[model samples]
Target chain A: MVKLKSNDDKEFEVEEAAVIQSEMIKNMIEDGCATSVIPLPNIDSKTLIKVIEYLNKHINMGKAAETGEEDDLKEFDEQFVNMGWEELFDVIMAANYLNIHELMELCCQSAADRLKNKSVRAVREMLKITNDLTEEEEQEIINDAPWAFEGPEIDDTVN
Target chain B: MEYGLIFLLINNQKLEIPQIILKSHPLQSKIVPKLTYNSNSCKTSSNTSVDKKVEEKSFATAEVATLMAPQIPSNESLPKLPQELITAILVRLPVKSLLQFKSVSKEWFALISSSVNGLIFYRIWFNSLVLWNPSTGKYKQLPDLMPTQMVTTGYCFNYGFGYDEVHNDYKIVALFREIRKHCVGAKIYSLKSDSWRILDDAQGEMLYDGSGKLVNGKLHWVTIVDGGWSIMSIDMVDEKCRKVEQPCYGVDQFSLTLGSVGK
Candidate 1:
C-alpha cells in the first residue's frame, strides 16, 4: 500500500500495483522516489478514487487477461461514466491532467457518446454553453446553407 | 452527418450529393442533434470553400505531423501526434486496424469514416461481402448480395485490380460465383475518379470458371458460359468485355498456353 495526499489535504491509501498503472506514478516509483506519501496537488480525492478503482479492476482481472473477454470489464467502465454530466467532465479533466491514457480515452469516448444523438439546443444546454458566434454570424452561416435543417420540425418535437 | 453521408455517397456513385448537404454540417467539435425536417438551423454557410478546407486541412495536418511532432523532441514520449500524421499512418494501415482505431477519437471518426467516398475501394462479391483496398485506407460496404456455392468460403474469392497502362486508369474487379447466373460482372473502379461503375459484362460469357485473374492488361476468369465452360478475358483498355474460347484441342491433350488474340 502507498499513501497519497490529495490537493485538498486529504490522505488516501492506494494499492501499489493499482496506483502504478499511472505511468507518471510508475516512473516516480522506478526512480526510487516514492517511499513516503506521494502528494498529488492536481487531483482531488474524489477523482483520484475513481482512477484508483479503474487501475485496481485492471490488475485484479489480470486473471482473464488472455481470454480477452474484457468486454464485461469494458461495460463496467462504461457504466462508471454514466454519472451526471458535470461529474463526467470532472473525471475527464482529472484524467487528462493525470495522464491516465485509458481513463482519458474512456472519458473522451463518453463525451463523444453524449454528443451522438443530441440537438444543437440540447448540445448547448448539455455543455452549459451559449453560442459564441453572434446571431448575425449564426444566421450568415445558416443562410449560405439550409439543407442541414431541410425537413425538421423542432417546435413540434417538444410539444 | 450530412457531409459525412455525402462523403460516403460520393464513393458510392449515388448521384453526386448536392453541395447543400455538405454546406450545413457543423465541425466534429460541434455536435448538433439528429436532423429533422424543420431545419431552419441548417441554412447559410455556402461551402464553396470546402475543397479549399480539405486542401488546407491536409496541408495543416502534414505541417503538424511532419513539421511539428519531431522538432520539439520532448523527454517523455508524447501521447498523440498531429492529426495529419495520424491520418497518414492510418492510410498506410490495414483495414482491420483502422476499423479498431476508428473508436479512438471523434476526429478519427471523421477521418476514418467510410462516409466520404471518392477513392476507388474494394469491389463487391456475393454474400454481403466486398473486396477492400488497404492501399487508399478505406473499406467499402457492399449491399447484401446473395452468395453462390463457390464463394460460400472466403478462399474461393479473388480480386483483380490494376492500372490500365494504355489509358492510365485504375480498375478493380471481384469474381466469385459458382453458377453463371450468380457470377457478378466485373465491377470497374477508377482511381482518377475514385468511383465504382459496372462495366458491361462480357455478354453470354461464363464468369465462374477458375476465377478472374489480372494478367497483362486484361481480366481473365473461367466461366461455364456458352454451351460448355470456357476461359474469358476483358480488355479494360478498349472497354471490350468478351469471351475467349478455349482452343480446338483439350487443354490437357497439349501444352496449351493462354495468349491474348488481339491488339
Candidate 2:
C-alpha cells in the first residue's frame, strides 16, 4: 500500500498497484521503490481523495469483464462531476494537480457544459475575469476589431 | 472517501492561478516550469482578476497568437458566468480557440460540445455577427447553432451557421455532402424550423473556407469563380451564390478584394 499525505494533514492509502497510475509514483516504484509514505504537499485532503478515486477507476478500466462494473462506475463519474460550479472548479484543479488525464478531460467537458449561450458581460461575470481593457480597448474589441470576436463555428443570424 | 486530485483556483478568478498550487499539481514533479497557463495569463491579463472590471480591450489575434498548451491542472478556477454567457463568448471565438479553451478547463469544453449550447455556438460562429438594427441602436451576440440535418442522417458533420434575426428567428444552415462517387450536393439545416433544410446551389464548390462577412443578414465571400476561380460569394439567407463585381477600368480581374461593409 501507498500512503499520500496532503497539506492539511489528511492521509489517503491506495493499493501499490493503483498508485502507479501516477507517473511520479510509477517511477518511484520502478526505481527499487518507495516505503513508508508519499508526501503530496500541495494537495488537500478532499482533492487527494478525488485523485485516488480516478486512479482506482482508471487502473480497473481493463478489468471490466470479470468486474462487470466499469461502465457503471463511469456513469458514477458522469454524475459525480455534475456538481455545482465551485465544487466542479475544485475537482478540475485537483485532477490537474494529480496528473489524472481522463479526469481532466471529463471535468473540463463538465465545466464547458455550464457556459453555453451567455454574453460577454456574462462570460466576464461567470469566469470572474475583469474586462481589463481600456475604454479604447473595450471599444476596439467590441467595435473596430470585429474580426477577433467572430466565431467561425457560430452563425450570424441568431445574435 | 475517494476523490480526484485538486488544483485550486483562488476566488474563481481567471488570473487567480496561485503559484503555490502550480508547483504542487500532480504533474508538477514532471512539468513545473514548462507549464505556461499562469505565464500565458500574465501575458494576456497581467494577473488581474475578472472581479473588478478593467477598462482594457482584449489582445488581437495578431498580438495574442495562441500557442500549444502545457499540462493542465483539473482544479483550476472556472469562469463565474452562467451557462448561456459562456456559450456566447465561445461563439465569438474561432473553432480553434474554442477547441483550445476546452483544455484550459473541463466546464468550458463540455459546453462547447453540448447538444444545446454547442448548437447555439455553432449557429453564430466565425466572425462576430454584427447586425446593425439601426432602429434600436443596440446589438447583442446571437446564440449558437445545432446540426439538425447531420443528426437526422446520423452522418458526420458538414455544416455552416449564421443568424437571421431579421426574419424573426435564429437561422442555422448546415450542409451535408452526398456520398455518391459521381455526384455531390449539400444539405442545409435551420434552427428556426428545427428540421433539415436542403440546398442545391453549392455549385459543388466550397467557398465557405474563405473569410466571409455577413452584412444586412447576407453572407459574402472573396473566392474563385467558375471560369478562372475568382472571388465569389453566397448569401446564407438567400442561398444565392454570386461573384463579386470588381472595378472594371483596366484593373486586374485576378486582383479581387472582399471586406465588410458597415450600414
Candidate 3:
C-alpha cells in the first residue's frame, strides 16, 4: 500500500497498482523514493479522494480490452467528469500536479465541452471576468463576423 | 498490502531498496523539505474537522456545486488557473465560440487570437478569393486572375489553398477550363510576393469543378486521363503535376471526387 497525505493533513491508503497510475508517483516509486508517505501539498483531501477513486477504477485499464470492460470504463469516465466546474477545476489542478495524463485530458475536455457554446456574456460571468472591451471594440468584433453571435445554439445561462 | 509488496519485490528484484533510499531520496528532500518524523504531530486538528463537515453534504449536482464551492472554506483560496490550462480549454472550443469569446476580455482576445493557427479561404464570387485569419483579423483579397473573364465563365474553376512550410508562404492553386476554346489553364498565387503566375505545365481534363483537397503539402484533384478517372496532385514545393496511383476499385463507378480528413 502507498500512503498519500493531502495538503489538509488527511492521509489515505491506496493500492500500489492504483496509485502508480499517476506518473509522478510512478516515477517516485520506480526511483525507490516512495518509501514513506507521499505528501501532495497541492492537492486537498477531497480532490485526492476523487483522484484515488479514478485511479482505483482505472487500475485494470490495460486488461479492460481483453475483459470486455471498456463500456464500464467509458460510463465511469462520463460520470466522473459530470461534477461542477469548481470541482472539475480542482480535479484538473490535482491531475496536473500529479502528472496524470488521462485525467488531465478528460477533465480539460469536460471543461471545454461545458464552455463550448456559451455566449461571451455567459463565459465572462462564469469566469468572473469583467469585459474590458469598449462598445466600439465589441461592435468591431460583431461586425467582423456577425454570424458567430447569431447562432441558435449559443447559451446565455451559466451552469 | 501483501500482494502489493510481492508485486513490488517481483518487479524491482530488490527488497532492500526501501532501507537504502530511506530519508535521503529526492521525494523526501525536494517535495517535503520540512519533513518531520512525527506524522501524528503535524497540522491536522482543524482541517480534519472542516473536511468532515464538507463530506457530510455528499456529492451535489454541477449547478449546486458551482453555487456551493465558493462558500466552502478553502485552505488556500483557489488560485487563478495557469495560462497553459486556460489555453488547453480554449483550443478545444469551436471556431464560432472562440470568435464570440473575443469580447470577454483583452487577455482572452489575445489568447483566442493566438490560439487560432490556420487561415480561412473562401470565394465570395466567381474567381474572387479571400484568405482570412479570424484570430489576427487580417485578410487579403487576391488580385484578379489574368484570365478572370475567361475563367469566371469557364466550366471548371477548381482551386485549393494551403501553407508551404518550405518557403514559409501561403499559396493558392486554381485550374480553370475555357469551354469555348476547350483549353484548361492553371494559376498559382503566392501570398508572400502578392502575385499570381500561370502554371503552364498543369495538364489534365478535370473530372469536376470542385476544389482540390490539400494533403501532405500537395493539392490533389480528380481528373479524367485517357478515358479513365485518375487522381492528379500538384506538389506545392516544385509546382509540378503528377498522377497518384488509384486504389483498385471495381472499374464500374465513374463519379470520383477527392477529399481528405484530419490534419
Candidate 4:
C-alpha cells in the first residue's frame, strides 16, 4: 500500500498499483522518497480524495480495454468530471501537480468543453475572469473579425 | 445512544462529515492561493490578503465543528495556473470560442492571434469567396464584385484571385466590357480593406475570353485584338493592366490558352 497525506493532514491508504498512476508519485517511489507517507502540500483532502477515486477506478485501464470494459470506464470518466467550476479547477490543479497525464487531459478537455461556443461575457462569467480590456480595444478586436461574432452557434448570455 | 446514532446518520447522509471537517483543518487553509486583479497592474497579484481572509473564516468556524458547513472556495480561489497549463486548455478550445474569448484578457488576445498559422480559400454558394484558416476554422468572405444589376443585365465578367506579398493581402481582379459602349474596364477588390476600386488607366477595346490565370502575383488572360490573340497581364502590385506580345507561331490561325510554365 502507498500512503498519501493531503495538505489537511488527512491520510489515505491507496494501493500501490492505483497510486502509481500519478507519474510524480511513481518517480518518488522509484527514488525511495515514498518510504513514508507521500506529502502532497498542493492538494487538499477533498481534491485528493477525488483524485484517488479516479486513480483507483482507472488502475486496470489496460485490462478493461481487453475485457470490453472501455465503455464503462469512459462513462465513469464522464460522470467523474461533472463538477462545479471551482471544483473542476481544483481537480485540474491537483492533476497537474501529481503529473497524472490522463487526468490532466480529461480535466482540460472538460474545461474546454464548458467554454465551447460560449460568448465573451458568458466565458468571463463562467471562468470568473474579469475583462480588463478597454472598450476601444474590445471594439477593435470585434471589428477586426466581425464574422466570428455573427455565427448562430454563439451564446451571448451567461448561464 | 439511539439519538446519537440518528444524528451520526444524518451527518453522514447529508453533510459527508470527513469532507466538510477537512475544510477547516489547518493545513488545508494554505492549499489555494489568493487571486487579486489590479487594474493598474493589469495582472493577478499573489498578495495573501484574500488567503488570510479564507484562513481566518475557516478557523473562526472550526469550533462549531458538526454544525459548520463545508466552505466552498470562492471564484478567486481558482488557481492562477502556469502559462503552459493555460495554453494547454486554450489550444483545445474551438476557434470560435477562442475568438470570442479574446476579450477576456490581453494575454488571451495575443495567444489566439499569434496561433493563427495558415489560410484556406473556398467558395460558398458558388459565388461568395472566402479565405479560411482550417487549423483555426476562422474565415472571412470577400465582398461581391458583381452587383444585382450586373447579374440581371447578363453582363459577362472575368475574375482572377491572387495574393500580394508586399501588402500581405489577397486581391480579386475583374475584367469586363460595357455592352453598348464596347469599352473595356478593370476593377480590383482588396481582401484587406474589403473594398473594390476601378483601375482608371484600364480603358481599351480588348475582348477577353472570360478565363483568367493567376501567376507570379499577376492576373493573365488571353484577349483577341484585331482578329489576333494576345496575352493581357495585370500587375496586382501596381494595379496596372498591360498587353504582352504573344510568341510567333507562323500565323497558324488557332486559339491559345493562357498558362504559366513554372519558372
Interface RMSD of each: 16.0, 11.2, 8.6, 7.8
Which prediction has the highest DockQ against the true structure? 4
What would the per-residue lDDT of candidate 3 be over residues B1-263, giving only the tens digit for each residue?
00000000011122111110001111111110111111111112112332232223222212232210112121233445543456557656677887688667755654443210133323211334555443334445567766455532323355777667689777888776543222567889888888888887774453332456667888887665544556788888888888898766543533353434324
In model 2, state the lDDT of residue A5.
Answer: 84
Order of the predicted models by lDDT, top scorer first:
3, 4, 1, 2
DockQ of predictions, in order shown: 0.03, 0.06, 0.21, 0.22
Interface RMSD score of candidate 2: 11.2
Kindly list the per-residue Cα lDDT of model 4 for residues B223-250, writing each as its tens digit. 6565455777887788788887665655
Q: Which ten residues in a row have the lowest lDDT in candidate 2 chain B?
A: B16-25
Candidate 1 DockQ category?
Answer: incorrect
Task: Please give the TM-score for the first chain of candidate 1.
Answer: 0.83
Stretches off by above 4 angstroms in model 2 are A65-70, A144-159, B1-263
* Per-residue lDDT of candidate 2, residues B181-205 (tens digit): 1122444444456544456665454
- Residue B62, model 3: lDDT of 21
lDDT of 3 by residue, A38-73 (tens): 887768999999999999999999899899999999
After superposition on all CA atoms, how large is the RMSD of candidate 4?
28.2
